[model samples]
Structures are given as C-alpha cells and as structure tokens.
Target: MSTWMIYGANGYTGELIARQAVRDGMAPVLAGRNEEAISKLAGELGLESSVFSLDDPATVAEKLQGMELVLHCAGPFSKTSRQMVEGCLTAGAHYLDITGEIGVFEMIHAPETSKRAADKGVVLCPGVGFDVIPTDCTAHKLKELMPNAVSLSLGFSFLAGMSPGTTKTMIEGLSGGSAERKDGKIVPFPMGSKKRTLDFGKGQQPVTAIPWGDVSTAYYTTKIPNITTWIPLSERQIRGARVMSLFAPVLGTKPVQNQLLKWVDRSVKGPDERARENALSYIVGEAKAEDGRTVTVRIKTTNAYTLTALGSLEVVRRMLGRDLPSGSFTPAGLFGSGLVESLEGSGKFEVVE
Candidate 1:
C-alpha cells in the first residue's frame, strides 16, 4: 500500500481531510508541528500520526520519507509553502496544497521549481480549493463550449460561512494590496471598488475584485488573454474591506497584520458543526470568443472546505493510481475537465450551462 501524509492534520480543514482519507481507506499519516494535537486526532480517527515542523528542513524531509504524496492543509501558505514544497521535492513525493495565495501559486510556477518537479517526474498541484478548482474548471468547461474563448469573467456567490483561518488569511491579503494581470502585465488594484453584480438564480449581489486563486490558475489553464475573479460580499463586509483597502499600505505593516489576525482568530469559528451544515460556494464564468460569441458555465457546491479536502484526496488517489501524467502542474493541467465531472459525481455540487 502506498503511504500518504496529511500535513497540518490537526487544523480544522486538516482534520476534515484526515477523516475523509480514512473513509476512503487510505489511512493517511496525520502530521504537523504540534505532536499532541496530531496524536489526539489520529487516535480518535484510528490512524497513524507523526510530527514534522516546516521550520526544520531535516525533520520535514525525514518525516516524508515513505509517503508517496502529501495533502498540505495548513496556511497562510505564503509563509510555509516554500519549505513544504522543497521538502516534498527532496523526498521525491507528489505534492498538493489548497493554497489561494497568489504569491505562493506564482512561486510554484517559477522556472526553477517547475523544472525541478518536472525533472523528478513528480506532480505538484496547488489551489485545490474553491479558489482555483471551480474557477479553472469553469474556464475549461466554457472553452469546451466556446472553443475560441479569448477572455473570461468569473464570479463566486457564497453565503455560507468562513473559517477563522480563512478569514485571517483574507484579511492579511487585503491589508496588502492585491495585483492582477491586466493587459498582459501585473497591476495593483484596490481590494474593493471593482464591484459587479452576479446573478445566482436567487438574486444579484454586488461582488468585489478580491484577489483569488483563479487569477493565476485560469491563465495557466485556458490561455485566456484576460481573466477576472470576484467574490460576493455583504454590504457591511464590503464597506469594511473598502476602508481597509484605503489604508492597505499602512495596515499591511507587520504589527497591524498580526493584530488583525489575532482578532479574527478570536472572533471567527474555524469549522463548527454549524458551518458544515450551512457552507456553500457558487462559481459562474463567462467566456468571450474572438468573433464575439459567448458561453457561460456555472458550478454550485456545499461544504466548501469538505469539497476542498475531497478534491485534494481525489487528486492524490489519481496520482497514486497512475491516472495522472507525471509532471509538476496545476489542477487544470493535471485533471482538466475530468476534475469538474468528478466533483459533480461526488453529489456535492451542480453544474449548469
């Protein structure tokens, strides 16, 4: 049997992945920097556990020795991904992470790392979450329908819930202004002001250009000349995000970001029972062909984090099962349209043309 590792297995999302892995009969090795937490969760789930801190390179490489793949759940990935990815590559293990950080995603696409992973014949898939999967898959689906699409407009309609860690990560990213490729070059954009309303059958809500994983993943997948991703926000949250955006340069300071993260951690719930019951994410994309023809694709799902775990697990299963091409790639290039179909078959989502 091939061994799999679930790093950060004690986190809310991490634990969820661990549970799903066990259910799939994979019996992953639950691992993290915190021994007690990992051990407790592993014991409860009837799985093995290990301790490996990303801060210690040798330890990480050692712990990953026998694993064929790893599902990294801990974030903010901006801080931890490099080391984790390096360790995985050093151990000759396939890697997957649910990272929405544009910086981290871009880093993985860097020439050196990309060449290294390719040369080693290992797979490196990032953004296996609501961020990239739904958007990238939607882009792929649209291209299938329109074949000649040159640009895309994507929006997410989500009313469900957010984990404390996710909230903190967003806050941190917002405090630092986000940049997107515009006219083929990266440009800074205010986190809020670019609002557009999206119809999700129920009603239309104003969405803002919050930096999302789709910005990077879509470029890699569809080769579209332009792509924009938006997320629906309540009026109040929009106001807060706008205000924060105004003072982003200052708020992005280390002390301020740390304070904001601490506050969010205390106020937001990571993943309570309520969140599991109420979570939802709807992604819609519009693709425009050169001749001005258009095609639209939409995907809706519940339990966003659960689906993220499921997506990552499915990717790992495919890699281990010899169903994926051996190369460092994003989800789109690795699984393509088949990924979207698999998620739909999971009975957790619906797709509409």
Candidate 2:
C-alpha cells in the first residue's frame, strides 16, 4: 500500500501531477469521487486508488487512514479543503494542496490550524503550486535583500487558460472582490482598485491588483505588513473587472454560479499539451522599506500548470525523503526561496536594488 495519495486525481491539474509522478518513478494512490475516472487513471498509471467524497468527515478520515501524505488537487477549495484538512488531522497525515485561494491560505495558516497540525505531528502546506510558489519565493528573496522592508508587491504575467475547477473557484468568489494585506491584516477592496506598470522580464505592462493568495501567505512567510498581488491585464479587462465588481454579490449566488459553472464545464478544457509545452510565466516582486530603499526581483518560469505539477511533487518527494518538521507552512517557508530555482524550468531571480 502506498503511503501517499493524490486526491482529485481525475482533475486536470491532479491528473497532470499524477502522470508526472508516475513518470518520475513514483506510485501514488489515485483517489477521487469519480469512480470511473479514478479507476481509469489508476489502471493507466498502474497505481492503487480509493473513491470517496468529502461530505462525511468520518468516511473521509477512514479513507485517509494509513496515508502519510495526501495531495489535495480538488476545487473550488473553499468547499473542499476543510473536510480534507480535518480528515488529515484525524488520520495524522501530512496535508498538501495546490490552492491559491486567499481564504484557504488564511484558513490553513490560522493559529488554531497550525496548533492542531503541530499536535498531530503533521505538516499542512497549501499553495504548493503555481499560485504562490514563485511569488512567495520571490518575496522571500526580496525580504532577504531588504530586511527592513515594510511593504511588498508581487505580480505575474501568465497568459494561460483556466481549468473548469479554476473557473468555478473564480465564480464562487466573484462577490468577495479583491484582497490585500495591510499592517498584517487581510482586507478586502474593490476589484481593480490598484494598478501598476512593471517589467516582468518583458516590457512594461499594466498589472491590476488581484486577490491572490500571497495577500495572506506572504505575510506568514515574510512578516511583511503590507502585501498586494497583481496580474497583467489590458485596459479593457481592468474596466470589465471594475464593472463585474458591482454585480459580485449577484454573480456569487447559487443559481448564478450553477449556470456559470455549467458553461465552464461545457467550454473550459484548460491548456492543451502544446500550450503547456510552450507556456512561460513571468513573476516580479518588490520590497520597499520605509526609508525609501527597495529591492525587486524577476523570474521566468514554466507553464503555471506544469510548474504546479513540478512544485507539488517536489515538495512531496522532499517531505517523504527526509525529516522535515511538523507544522503549517507557506511553500517557501518550509522549503526556502531556493525551491523556486530548483524546479525544471525556473530561472534564477534577477535582482535589482
């Protein structure tokens, strides 16, 4: 019996991770609620699998028994992570998930959650994927360069399509607007409220503030009091986001979400193989001290989904192959900023002071 499992193995991102894990000579148990999809993937990869839903805590815990680690890849994590996290606590299994949701990061990094993970002798690390790994690492690097920094800004430029799960997650949070960290507290703001022009390895482009997970995780990692995240966007897209902000509550309704998700399910197929092969993402981060000193770093990395697969599996391998401490962590908190450059397609950060 394998000690590790990949929940939501049938999901687009989950399947990518599972396949890559197999290619790297690891045999992780594939588990998900979709019996046929899970079974099919398991058979194709020649690995064990379990089928279960997260609706029942007892059932989830029972299924998680004997698992030392579980890579949760299902979403929207707002609805799925709680059950999995609780089950991992009960089963004494270390938990890792590829979540970039600000709320999910805050939930997992809360003091109570950290205490429970410590008591159970398990590590809980979310956002091990594309969501925050690069940005978090870059932020950590900037902190090292400017130890007295009081604020940090992170941004990325990745022109990739979203998976159905990702789309659904966005739909669920449409009403929440965007978020940023101020004085070490997470605060919500209107969508597209802030914008910046940064050179993400490419030319200068306008990036709009987004409710990226770094708004929460970066605070935990760097203790930076103020943090804002951004993504490249066109003027039209910025306007669209502002207009959408007005209807966030309505768009977040159950009926509206259901209808929108139906369209996502029908149309969203994520990036195809060719796109994944050619995908490149650029990340930029700047840390500014109150005394007017600043440090900025930029990174060029692989595709978001590909990087997610690589980052998650790399974390799993290191955790299983060594004696890392048991506690909650941001990806860079446990692994260090070097983790970003250790990946296959990651380039060393170009620092500018």
TM-score of each: 0.92, 0.98
Candidate 1 structure quality by residue, lDDT tens digits, 160-249? 577776887887776666556565444667776677777655677777776777777777777776777777787778777778778877
| lDDT assessment of candidate 2 | 0.92
Name every residue pair that clashes in candidate 2. none
Off by over 4 Å in 2: none
- The lDDT leader among the candidates is 2
Error of model 2, residue 90, in angstroms: 0.7
Prediction 1 global C-alpha lDDT: 0.77
Which predicted model would earn the best TM-score? 2
Tens digits of per-residue lDDT for model 2, 122-225: 99999999988999999899988988999999999886788888888888889899999999888899997778788887688988999999999999999999
Q: What TM-score quantifies how close candidate 2 is to the native fold?
A: 0.98
